[model samples]
Target chain A: MSADNLTRTQRDDLRTIAAMIVPASDAYKVPGADDPAIQADMLATLGRDTKLVAAALDHLARLAGGPFAELDANRREAVAQEFRKVGGAAAATLVRVVLQCYYRDDRVLRSLGLELRAPFPKGHVLPDGDWSLLDPVKARGGTLRRAP
Target chain B: MKDPVDVLIIGAGASGAAVAWSLAETKMHILCLEQGGWMNPAEYPSTGRDWEAKFYGEWSSSPNVRGRPEDYPINDDNSPIKVVNYNAVGGSTVMYTAHWPRLHPSDFKVKTLDGVADDWPIDYDALTPFFEENDRIMGTSGLSGDPLSPLTHPPMPQQPMGLSGAIVGKAMNKLGWHWWPSDTTVATMDYEGRARCINLGHCTPACAQGAKSSTDITYWPHAIRAGVELRTHCRVREITTDENGMASGVVYYDKDGVEQFQPAHVVIIACNGVGTPRLLLNSKSNRFPNGLANSSGLVGKNLMFHPYAQIYGYVEEPTDSNRAPPTCLWSKEWYDTDLSRGFVRGYGVQFVRGAGPVFEAVVSEQKGILPWGEDHHRVFRKLNGHRLGFSAICEDLPEEHNQVTLDPVLKDSHGIPAPKIDYTISENSRKMMEHALARGREVLETAGATDICINSPIPWGGWHLLGTARMGTDPNRSVVNEWGRAHDVKNLFIVDGSIFVTSGGVNPTSTIQALALYIADQMKQRLANLFD
Candidate 1:
C-alpha cells in the first residue's frame, strides 16, 4: 500500500508531521518536505514505506490523546518522542523515505548546487592541477624494500 | 558447448577474463562460464538521474543486498566486514573505483620480513614483467617515479586530480608524507581503443562512461574476437572429476535453469576466493570424500579482507560535486609497517572526492545530524558538496580461523550452496586503523577540513576478497601451489585472489591480473609437464 491509500485525516497528520520533520527554512531558500508539490511527490513514491507512515500517524494520534494534526507543537513533539521510543525502526524508515523524496526533488537538488541530470555522456570536466606540486616528494626520492 | 573442450574456465570475472585472454593466443578452444550476463553501458545507473540511489538497490556492492539473479548470495552475517562483488563479465571490476596500485616487493616475503603470513612462491620481481604487460592491457593511467614500486611508467598520463585532490596533495606535501598521483585503470588518454574518461563522478556500481577498465570492455571483447567463447548466465554448481582424480568438466545451471555439463582437458577455477572454494568443496566424490583437491584441507582457509576506514570532513571551499573519479591521489606514508604502532602491515590512504547530492543526504540522515524541520536544510547544506576525505585500506593478515565455508542452509537460485564468511578484525588491524585515523585526521585538518568525522573500520567495506586458497609450496598448508595449480588435482588450477599469500595494503587488481597472466604463461610453458 502507498500513501495515496491513506485517508484525508491520516494524510493531514502525515503532512503536519512531515513539516515538523523538515519545516521550510528562509536562509536555506528551501521549502519544507510537506510543501504541497513535495508532499504530493513523496506520497506518490511511498511504495514500501506506506505502512510505516500510516503506523507513525496512528501511533502519534494515540500518544497525543487526540488528532496529531490538532495537537499543539509541544504536545505533538512530545508524542513523536514517545512514538519514536516505541517505533524506532519505523520512524527511521519514515525519515528515510521523506529525505529520499525531498533530496530527489529538482528544486531541492538545485539548492544543493546540483543539477538533476544523469552523470553520463555529458560528464563534467575536472580542472587539471599543476604537476609541479610533486617536486618536493621527488626530491626526497625513496625506493621499494626489495625482497631477497 | 564443446563435448571435450581444451580448457574450461569457471567464472568470467577478473582473473578468468585475463587468463582467458592470455590463453587465447594458443587458440586451443578456450571457454569461460560466467554467472552474470554482459553489462549494457546504456542501462547502467549513471545514465539515469537516480544513480546514487541505485547503490542501495540493484547495483549494490553487496550481493546479499543487490539480490540480482546473476548474483549468488554470500552469507556474511557472521563477518564484520561484508563481502562485496559484482557477478558479471567483469565481476567486481564492474563496480570498482579503478584505484590501481601494485604490491610492493616486501609484500611477497611476508614471512621473512614480518614473520606473519607465509611467503609467496612468486615474488614481485618475477611478476613485474606481467604487471607491465597487464598495465598496458588494462589501459593503466599513471606517472612513473613513485619510489614505492619498481620504477616504470604506465601507458597513459596520470588522471586529472581536480582542486579537491590538489588541496589534499598540498596538505600531504606540507606534512612531508609520501603522497603521489594514484595509478588508476580509468582511461586518461586514447592509448587503447577506449577514449579519455569523461569524469562520470562515481565509477562504482557501474561506469556508464566506459572509461574504467572493467575487463568487460578491456579483455572480453579482444578475448571473444580471438575465438574465446564466454557463455553467460551459466552458474557452475560443482567441478566434475575423472576416474584419475583430474578435473574433467563441470555441471552448471544454464540461462534457462537447465542442468548442463561441459567437459574439458584442463579446468581453471577463477571464481574468486569464495566461489572457488565453494565449487571445490561441493565437488565431493568417492575417491576424494572430503572434496576435490582436499588432500591439503586448506581450500577455504585464511580469509583476508582489506577492511577500510573513512575519515572525512567538510571543507570550507566549494569542492567539485563528485565531477571526477572517486579516488584521486593516494598516500603510502603509513604503508610501511612500523612495529611500534602495533601492526605488522600498514594501509594505503585513498584520497577521495566528495559524495554526490543523494549520497550526501543519505549519509547525513544516517548520521542523525540532518534533523527534520528547520535544521534539516541547514545541516544538509553544511555536509553536501564541500566534503573531502580519505579511506584507509588496512592490510588484513591471514588467519586460519577467518574462513569461507559452504553454508548448509542457504543456496543460490540454482540450488548451489552459498559460501558463508566468518571474519574478524585482529588486534593488529585495530591498532593500524587507530594510527590511520590519527594521521588521516591530521591530513584532512591540514587540507582545511573542520569537524573531522572518523568512521573507523567502515563495515560493508570488504571490497578486496583474498587469501582463501593461499599459494605456498607446502601441500599441507596451501591450496594452490607456486604457479596457481592445485596440489591434489593436477589438471585443476585456482587463479584469482584465492591464491594470494598475503593481502597487501593496496588495490590487488594490478597484482591479480599480473598473476593471472603469469599463471597462464606458466601453463603454456609447462604444457608437456603441466600435470606433473
Candidate 2:
C-alpha cells in the first residue's frame, strides 16, 4: 500500500520533516533513512491495497502536527523528535501497520531510486561457527534449523 | 486406538530438536509435535531494531519477559518467574544467543568432589565423543587448549570477533585465568549455504541470514527432508499407555482444542528441563500415579538453574564492543573451585561485548536512572561504545526443595497447569557469586577500567535449564538411566538438560546435544533388537 495519498502540500511537509531527522552532515548526509521521495517511488509498485499507504501517511501527519510541507527544518526535526519521545503504544502500533503497507509496495522504490530485488549485501551475524573439528565417526548432517 | 509411532517428540526447540536429529538414524517412526506455527527465513522476524515490537511483543527478550500487564499468569505486577518462551515450531531456538560451551568433566561428578549435589551416572569421558560430534553438526567455534576437548581434525575455521575479545583475553591472562574463544553455535564463516557472521546488531528474534545454528535452521529441516513429519500447533496433553505398560499413543488437543490421539510405540520427552517434567507430571496414568515414568518420584525434583551475576564496566573512550558479532571471548579458569575459599563449586565467567541503546537505557533505568529524556540520551550515547558487561554463571547445586510445582491456580491456553518455580539461592551459591564478583572486579582492574558497576546477583534464567529428570545409576533415585532411558520404562527416553545430574557453571546446549547423540547411538543399537 502507498503512504496515505498525501495532498501536494502534505507531501512537501513530509519531505521537509524527513530531511531533518538525518540532516546533511559532513560525515553522513542521509537525506532520510525512509524518505518520502523514495516512498513515492515505492508506492507505484504496490501489491496489496493502496489505501493502507494513505492511512500511514495520514497518521504520520496527525502525529507531526500541521501540514508536513509547512514545517521548517527545526519544526520537522521537532516533530520527528516528539514522535521518538511520545511514540508509545498508539504511535508505534499505527506506524507499524503503515510501514507494512509501504514495505509491500514495489513502485515506491523506483520513484525513490531504490532497488526492490537487491539483497542486503552485508551478511548477518549468526551464532554457529566451524563444524570441521568434529570427528568423522559421528558427524551428523542436517539442514540448519530456523524459526517456522 | 491405533498403535503409536515408536517415539513422539514435543516442543521442537534446541534440546528437543537435538534429541530428534540424534535419533534420526533409528528405524522407529518418530512423530515430532510443536505448539507453535512453522517459520521461514524469508518471513522470519525482520532485521530492524524495531522488529521485535511488531511480533506481539510478548516473545521479545526483556529484563522481565512475563508478558503484557494482563495477558497471562506471569506479568509485570506479580511473578518474578518471567516465563518468556515462544510457542512456535522451532520454539525459543528462533531467538537465542547461541553460546554453546560443553560442561567441564568435573561438573558431572560434583557430589563426589564437593560433597554437594548427586554425581551423574555417566561422566564427561562417556559424553566427550558425543560433544565432538555435536560441535561438527552445530558448527561450534573455539580453540583447542582445554585438556577436556578431543583433538580437532581441521581445527577452528574462524578467528574470534573484535577489540573486546583481545581486551578480555589480555585481562584473563593477566589474572592467570584460562581464556579461549567461546565455543559458540554462531556461524563464524559461511557454512551449509548460510552466510558468515556480519556484525549485525540483532541476534535474537531470528537471524536474518541463517547463520545462527538454531535447531530449526540446523536440524528440523533435515528431519523433515528425511521423511520426518512435523506437526505444529499440536499440544500433547497426555501419553496414554496400554495394559502391558507400554506407551500406545499420545492424546493431544489440536490448535482448535479438538481432542486427537497420535499412536506411537515409544515416546521421547525432550520438552526441555521445565516443560519435560511438567508434561510427565501432567501425563498421570494408572500404573504411574505420580506421572508417567515417574515411579521414582524424582521426575520433577532437584531442579537446578545456573545462577549468574552480570558486572558492567564503563570506560571514558569508545570501545568497539557492539560493532562486531556478540560474544567472542570467555574465561573458565575459575570453573573448578578450590573449596578452601569457602565456596563449594565455582563459576564460569564470560564477557559479553555490549548492549544496544534500548537495552542500555533499560538497565540504566532499572538502576533508578531516568529512562527517557536528555539524561537518558546522554548516558546512552556515552555507553554506546565504551561499555562492557561480564556474566558469571555459578554452579547451582540440585536441591529437592527448589522444584517446579504445578501452579494450582495458573493454566496455559491449552488448559494445562503452568509450572510454578519455587527457587531460592543456596548459601554455597551465594558465596560462589560473591567470589565471582570479586574475580570480575580483579579482571576490570587488570584491564585499567576505573568506572565499573557490579550488578547484584540474580536467579538464573535462559536456555540453560537442567537437572529435573536426572540420570543416575540407581533406579530409585533417578528418572532415567545412564543412557538417558527411563529406569522402569525401557522404550521411553529423555535426552536434554532434564537428564542432567549436576548443574554446571557453563551453558548446557553443547553438552545436552552431546548427550542426545550418545543416547541416540544407544537407541540405534537397541532398535535392531526391539523393532526388527
Candidate 3:
C-alpha cells in the first residue's frame, strides 16, 4: 500500500514510533522491533508509513514511553495505567482516533493479527437434518449450563 | 421421493427451524431446505476475543447467518430485506442478538387502541401456551418481575451478566422501575451436552463455547435426531402450485446453482420479513397473478423497524466495557400504556456496557474530540476508566407509509429485483422517542454518570425489521389468518417477523420463534388428518 509515500525522515520517525506503540512482551512480541523479520507482513500490508500510520505509532509510543524495544512489562503497563488515570471522556477519543488509523493501516492489522474486512469462511456443512436417521448420539436435556 | 413430504420447509432460520423442530416431534416426514452450507463447530467466532473481526469478514465468516451476498440479495435501494441473514444450518439464529421479550396483550389489538392497523386474528391469550413452550425450549433466562410474562414452571436457568445488569438493576431499583434479566436463549448450564457460555464476548456471529442456543446448536440437533432431513445451500426460488391452487412443490436454485424441483404437499416460507414477502411476490402462477398468498394486495405494506437511540455517558469507574456478550440488561419500565405522559404505547430502556478500549478510542477520536499529536495521547488516558452507554428502543406504530416494494430496475445475483424500501417514521414515533429520552436521562442521573451525552437521531437501519406481512382477523385487511396461514392459499404458510401485528419495544426473535412453533403445531395437526 506504500503509505502515501513517506520521506526518509518520516519513515525513520514512524519506525521509532511504531516500536514504542507496540512494546515487546514475553507473551507475544510486538510485530515490529529491531528484528527485521518481524512485522514484515504487517509492513507490506499496511503500506509502510503514512501520516495517519505515523500518528498511530507515535500515539502508542507516547503512551508507553521509550521505544517498545526498551520497555519491560512493568514499565509498559505503567504507561497503560496512565491511560486509565486520564478518565473515559478524553481517553475514549484518543483510542478511537488511533484505532481508525490503525485499522486502515495494514501494519496495525498484521500487528493485531487481523485482515482488512475479509469475507466469512465458505463451505459450511449444515446438518441434513438427518442426525437421528444417522444414529448420532442423542444428548437431549442439555440446556442446563450455567450462564457466563 | 415416492410420496412427497407433507411440508417442505425452506431456510432453517428462526421460523423455518422452529417449524421443522415442532413438526419433527409428531413423526411427520419433513424435509428442510437451506441455501447455505454447514458451519464448522471449531470455527465458531464467539469462542475467543478476536472474534470481533468476524463482523468485517466475508459473508460466510460473518457472525450473522445472512453472510453471503447470495443469501441476502436486495434490490437497488436496499429496501427489500435490507438486512443480512445467516445461511448455515441454524439460519439467522447464529447471529441474532438474543433479546427475547413477549408482545404485550394490547399489541394483538393495535387498531382498537391506536386507531390504526388491524387487530390480530388470534389474541395474546391464544399464543400464550406457545410462548411458554418457546421459553421452555429456548431456555429463556428471565426474572419473575414482569407480570406480563407469567412463566413459573421453567425458572430462568441462567443469571444475567455482572456489570451492566448490576448497574441497570441498581438504577432501576432506586427509581422504583421494573427490570429483569433479559430473556435470552444462551445456556446457563451444560444443558443437552452443549458447553456453557464461557462469556467469550461474541454472541452475534457464533457462540465460542457453545453456550448460546441458536437453532443449529439446540433445536436442529433434536429435530435431526427425530428423523428430519436438512439440505443446505439450496435457495428456494418460488412455490409451484397446481391448477387446484394447492402448492405442489417449490422450484429452487440448489447450492450448485442448478434449478431443482422440491415437490411437496405443503410449502412453508419462513425466510424472514424481507425474503418471505419477496418470495410471495415472485411466485406468480397461472391460477393467481398477484403472486402467492397476497390476495389482499398488502404483502409488503406496513413495514415497521423499531426506532432507537444510543445515549452514552462518561462515568468514573472502570465498567470493563470489553466483557463477553453484546447486549445484557433490558428495562420495560416505560413499556406500557403510560399515555398520561402524552404517548400512545410506551418504550423500553436497555442498558449495555460500551465498546472496548480500542473500539471506544476509535469512536471518540473520529469526533475529533482528540485530534492527533499530544491531544490524542491525552484522550487515551481519559478513556481507560470509563462507564458508558444505555440504548433506548422506542416502539414504532404500524404505518402504511413504511413499506417494502421490489425495485423496478435493479436485480440481485438471482435475477430478482432488489427490495426497495419506502419508509418514514410516523409522528407517533417522534413522540415515543421524546418520552424514552427523558426516562433515560433520569437513569443516568440516578447512576451518577457525569458528562452525559444523548445521541438519538431517528434510527436508520437494523435487522429488527417487522410488521410487513401482518396477521389480522379480517381477511380483507390482513394477509394471513389466525394461524399464520395465507388467507387465500390453503397450503402456503408465512411464519416470521412479517406476521407481527405491531412492533414491540423488545427483540422480536423470541416472539418470532414462538409464532413459528404455534403455526408449526397447527400445520402438524392439520397435516396428520390427511387420511381422515
Candidate 4:
C-alpha cells in the first residue's frame, strides 16, 4: 500500500497502459481513463493496490526487456501484447482496478446514458414484457415425471 | 441462562427464521442465536454510484472473501467448487437470487424412480401444504400451471418477465421444450408485510429495495413479533449434551467475546449444511464419542452442491438487461431422468439477464472476448446490454466421498473449528452439465444470439450447500429420522438444508423453509410425545 515503493517510472507506465486500455472515445464523447481528473482519482485509489500495480509494472518491463515508460509507442504495444499473453494475478488486479475506476467515473457513466447515482432510492424499471410468449410451452405441458 | 428455555435454535438464517415464526404459534419460550447481525438496506452497496466497483469488497457473497467477524472460514481447497454464503440474519438469502422453485414429486423418491439416490423419508406430496404456506408467507411471485414444478401459482402474481425472458421463452418454444416464468420469492406488488420491487439489478450483493423476500425481511420480523427472541452476534462454539445422551443446549461467545452456556428443554439446529455438521462433529462428549447424534457416521458425509453451467452469448437487440431482476424464466426440459442422455437425473435451466457495465467489462476481458486495447470499445459495445444467457443448475447425487469435515487448522473468530469441504463434481452431474450446455447453446442460437460462451461447472456456484446431515428411516444411514428429530438423541432436531437426502436441480431455499415449517408443525402436533 506504500506509494513510496512504486517507482515514478512505474506510475507513468501504469497511466500509459490505462490510456491504451480505454482510449478517448470521440464518437461516444467520453474521455479516456487517463484523463487528468480521472487519472488522479485512479492514482489516489491505487494507494492500497500499489503492490499489485508495481508487480504488474515490473512484469511488463521484464517481459519488454526494459522500463515500460521509456518504451516507444510501437514497443509499448508489443510489450502490452506480451504482457496480456503472459497474464497473471497482478495484471488481472490492475485491469480490474482500472476498469472499475473508469466505469465509476461520472463522465463515462453519462455517456452510457445511465444516472450518475446509486441504483437504489430510485431503482430502475422495465416494461412488463408479453407473457403470452409461454403459450406454446403451455400448450405442450406435462413434462414432469411422476413419483413411483 | 439460569432458566432453561423451552426451545433453543441456532443460526437465525433461512430455515431457523421460518421454524421460529411457525413455532411461535405455540407461544412457547423459543430463542434463536445468530452469529451475524441484521443488515441495513440503507448501507447496501446499491445505494452508491460506485456500487458495481465497490461491492467486491464487504458485500462479496463469498464468506472467505468477505471475511467479516461473524463469517467462518471454509477450507474449500479440496473442492473444485468454492462455497459462497453471507453471514447475516437472513443467511445466504441476503445474497440469494431468489429463484424459488420446489422439488418435483419424483425428487423425493429418486431410488424408486431413477434408482440413484436414497428416497426421502417424506415425499413432495406431504410437503405441498407447507410449501404453499411458505409461499404465502414469503410473498412468492409466479404464474400458475408450471407443470414442471411441484407447486405452481405462488401466492403473488407472476413477476413481469422483461424482454430477456421473452427472448428465451420464444427460443425454448422453437425447440419444443419446457419453459415457464420462474417462481421467485421477490415481491411483484406490495404485499402485506413487504414492498414492491423496483428492479435494482444487483440481486447477488443484496437488494436494497426490500423487494427480495429474504427471511430477515419476511420471517424474522414476524417471528420477533410472535415472541421468539433472536440474539445476534452470538457464535455458538459447540452443542452441549446431557448425561443421558438427550438434548441439551449450546455454548456460545457473545458480542463482547464472553463465553456463556444457555440450556434448553429442546435443541433445534437450523444452521445450513456446513455449519450444522461442523457443530455436531465438534460437540464430542463421552455419551456420543464420535459426535453428538452421529452414531451412523454419516454426519458430514454426502455433501451435495448444485453444479452451475453458465451459457450466454451476444444478441443484436438491446434488452432491459441490468435494469431488471435477472432470473424470471426457467426450462425443465431436461429436468426429468433420461437414461439415453448418459445421466440418471437432469438439470434446470434458469435464464439470466445480461450483465451490467462493470460485469460486462470485467467478465468479457476475463473471457478474452473484449480486449483491453484498440478493439475494446467495438467488442464492448457489441456485448453490452445485448448479452443473454441461462445457467444450468445441475442436481447432485449423494456420494459419501464428498463430505464436510471439521477443519483442524482453520477456526472462526469464536475459536470454533471451521468446516472443511471435500467435494468433486460427480460424473453424473458432469454429464448433466454437458447436456445442458449443448442444449442451452442451441436455444440461444435459435434466439438470434451469436458469440456463444459456456463456462461449465463453474467453481463460484457453490450457493446451495445441502445433504451433509441427511434424513432417512435407517439409523445406520442418516443423522435425523423421518421428522427431522435425531434418532440418537431425543428432543434434538435439525431443520435446515443439512437434512436434504438429495439435491434437486432448482434453488433449495423455498424447500428449506417449507421443511422447517413442516418440522415445526410436527413438533406442535406431537407436543405431548415429541420427546419420544
Runs with alpha carbons beyond 4 Å of true place in candidate 3: A1-148, B1-3, B47-49, B59-70, B75-84, B147-155, B368-370, B454-461, B528-532
DockQ of each: 0.66, 0.06, 0.05, 0.71
**Residue A19 displacement (Å), model 3:** 12
Q: Where is model 2 more than 4 Å wrong at Cα?
A: A1-148, B1-3, B43-46, B52-56, B62-84, B147-156, B369-377, B458-460, B528-532
Output the lDDT of residue B89, model 2: 62
Residue-level lDDT of model 4, residues B1-532, one tens digit each, is 5578999999888999999999999999999999999999988878887688755557777788678898999999999899998888999989989998888888888999987789999988788889989988888898888877665657778877787877887788888988888899889899876779888888778889889988898888889998999999999888888888887788989889999999999999999889899999999888888888899999999999999988999889887678888898888888888899999988888998887888788878878888876677777778889989879999999999999999989988877888999999988888888888999889889999988987877777899999988999999999999999999999899999999999989899989998999999999999999987
What residue runs in model 1 are displaced by over 4 Å at the alpha carbon?
Answer: A1-17, A43-71, A79-91
Error of 4 at B527 (Å): 1.6
Q: Give the best candidate by DockQ.
A: 4
For every candidate, C-alpha RMSD to the true structure in Å? 2.3, 9.2, 10.9, 1.8
> Which of the two candidates, 2 or 4, achieves a greater DockQ against the reference?
4
Which digits, one per residue and each the tens of the lDDT, describe model 2 over residues B1-532? 5455767887687767777876776655778887767776765544443332333344454323334221223221222223445556666667667776667766777767777777777877787777777777777666554433324331245445465665666666555566556667677678766666665545665777777777777778777776677878788787777887777778887768788999887788777777788888888877888888888888778877777777777666555443455666666666776878788777777687775433443445445342333243345445555676688888888888767656777777667776777766788888888888888888777776755776755421444567889898898999988887888776678887899988888877778778888888777777766422
- Stretch of 10 with least lDDT, candidate 1 chain B: B365-374
lDDT of 4 at B262: 94
- Poorest lDDT segment (10 consecutive residues) of candidate 2 chain A: A137-146
In candidate 3, what are the lDDT values of residues B1-532, reduced to their tens digit? Answer: 4368877987788878888888887786789888777777677754333344334344233223233644545542433223545667777777766667777666666667665556677777777888888777766665444443334334454344455555555666677665555667776566666765555555666665666778887788888988989988787778888887888898877767788887897788888777777778878777778778777788888887777766766666555354545566666666766668787776776676655544555555444443443344445445533655677677777877677777777565567655667766677777877777777778877877765666564222356768778887677788888787788777778889999888867777878988898888777677645312
Candidate numbers sorted by lDDT from highest down: 4, 1, 2, 3
lDDT by residue for model 1 (B37-87), tens: 999999898898767766765777989878899999899999888888889
Q: Output candidate 2 Cα RMSD.
A: 9.2
